[model samples]
Target: MVLFVVAKEETLQKPMYLLLCILAVTEIGGTTCIMPKALCIFWFGFKGITVDGCLTQMFFLYLFAVTHSAVLVIMAFDRYVAICDPLRYTTILSNARIAKLGLVGLIQAVLLILPLSLLLRKLPLCANPVILHTYCEHIAVVKISLGDTRVNRMYGLVITVVNIGLHLTLIGLSYGLIIRAVLRISSKKAHQKALNTCTAHICVMLMSYTPFLFTALTQRFGQDNAAHVHILLANLHLLVPPMLNPIIYGIKTKELREKTAKDKDKGSNDKAELLSHTYSDPAGA
Candidate 1:
């Protein structure tokens, strides 16, 4: 829905909305990587995944996750540009530039995760391997495998620190700068307006990252017997942002909200007209 609305709505073709569309795609991919199998396990108790399947799941899960983190940082940058330098926002965040950033983020995810996947592939599994959790998470899979996993654990730790830590730092810096810029505005209305623009973004970032970092830490350090707690945290990290981002954006953004309302009205009018015609002229095809 976000992608379609952004593509068709002329007013929503700005860099921010474009980023939202990319974020939406990442959310879809991230959820797709885990939701089906997790649900099947919970509902039908069918917990089966081959070695190849587990590797594939691990690759995609982190790929989308890393990509999602990058997008959040970029969105913070977007807000920074819009707030700190309104006059040059377009020149600074041109469509081509945003595309380049998205491409770089995807390449970064591949570079970081592909080697880890290869390392995971070399680990030996038992005759009947069972991940102590719902899905074949990278950490869970590594826990269940035999042989030295120090390299895999080290690589994952480095990736998490570099990817999640760096992104969080950058986002924090962007917001700090944004706050400074907002404060510099003299008029009361202007300050509030600038802050208002960032409200939805800050909320979304909190929703995206808090559970994510907690889940990552839990996967690495939590008690072995608390697998269920870890599983719930992981699902919340993967699932919540995607569910709420659209709602937050739609309610907070004037242009998107109005566009959706217009479309809804148009659809209702079309439906009513079709029904009226059918009732008035039943024999007419």
Candidate 2:
């Protein structure tokens, strides 16, 4: 639905919409990486996955996750430009530039996560082959490995800290500036309007990161935590954002709502016209 709307609607050809389209694709890709296998395990009792296959799945899962985070950072920048610098927003975030940003996000994720898979390949798994979680996760895979995982752990920590920290920092900075700019407006209506534009993105960003943060922290620090809780949070971290993003944005964004309403009205009119024509020609038939 998001792809169709963004592609067909000329009014949605701006950088904000382009970013949204990219985000939609990222969400779909991220969920696709894990959901099918998860459903297979749940419904068909097919839980066994080979080491190489698990690694592959983990790679794509983290790749999509990292890319999603990077995309959120880009979105923060988008909102920042839209709110803090309205006149120069177009100049700074042109279509080509937005496309480039999307590409960069994907590329960065691949580069950062590719090494983890390579490291996984080196680890010798002597423990039970069964993964506790629904899908293959990097930490879970590494934890089960018997080989020296010092390098993998160090690298994983670095990547997590750097990737998540950088994204959060940039988003925070962008929102800080946006808030400052928004507060400068004397009119309460203008202030509300400007903040309203950012509200959806803010919700999305929080939704995207909060679950993962809790899960990661708990996995690392909480020694007495339940396995089911960890698994649940991990799955939710992957599934919730993709499923809810379109609905949230559609409800929060006026343009999307208007477009949806227009499409519905057009369909109704077409159906009515077809019914009228059919009735009118009944005698001829």
Candidate 3:
């Protein structure tokens, strides 16, 4: 909400602000669309899939999947700018540049997940169709398909490799640079602050990525109530980070706190201006 308002005005020139907005929007989509669909499928079961509904759910799942993955990539880049190129960080991660990266991420996500629909669409639903967890996840949904899921399995393998491999590569690179930067900082305070920032990001990444990887591996290896564990972890992966991000940033970063204060000031000023303008005519005279 604050990001939306900050982005609306011209004064907020911070690159990180735009990054925050991108993160917020992406997480909102993940939480609202992906989480709910997964939970609904797990809890209530699918409501008689029409040919259209299946396709629609699949599309939304695709959208959520891509956006979530892309957002992680975007964040890795953001960290890179902040740590690796602090001097040119503003120019490197300008609003336009961030917007472009975000678009590319979104596009990449969409393209990557498009195959899932094609691969899994025609496969027959299983007999004992109970999603172990609270969501209709890509893998869980696919697990029960009676048809030859070799193609689906292959595509899933590709997605797992690409998504995990790419995002982890970028994140690893960013943190490598970040660690160097932190080490170079003479001030203990500065080093601690840098470590603290990345700590939240690292925690989020662990929570988000670990379950997906575990689930994928377990499925391939003939796992058990691991599905139930995977489902619980999956929900936590989606829910915990998003809920934590704003709170952590708000509490830890002085810049964000100041910006929030300034935003409040700006709001008060705007309300004052409106009141003055409204009564500034003959009534005031």
In model 1, where is the ten-residue run with the lowest total lDDT?
219-228
TM-score, prediction 1: 0.96
lDDT of 3 at 121: 78
Clashing residue pairs in candidate 3 are 38-134, 38-135, 38-136, 39-134, 39-135
- Going through the candidates in the order shown, the clash numbers are 0, 0, 5
Q: Give candidate 1 regions above 4 Å deviation.
A: none
Q: Residues 85-159, candidate 2, lDDT per residue (tens digit)?
A: 789988999999989998999999999999999998988897667677898887788778888999998898899
After superposition, which runs of candidate 2 have C-alpha atoms over 4 Å from their true positions? 283-285
Root-mean-square deviation per candidate: 1.5, 1.7, 4.6
Residue 50 CA displacement from its true place in model 1, Å = 1.2
Candidates ranked, most accurate by TM-score first: 1, 2, 3
Error of 1 at 80 (Å): 0.8
As for lDDT, the candidate ahead, 1 or 3, is 1
lDDT (CA) per prediction: 0.89, 0.88, 0.71
Error of 3 at 220 (Å): 4.5
Error of 1 at 101 (Å): 0.7
Error of 1 at 149 (Å): 1.1
Task: Give model 3's TM-score versus the native structure.
Answer: 0.77
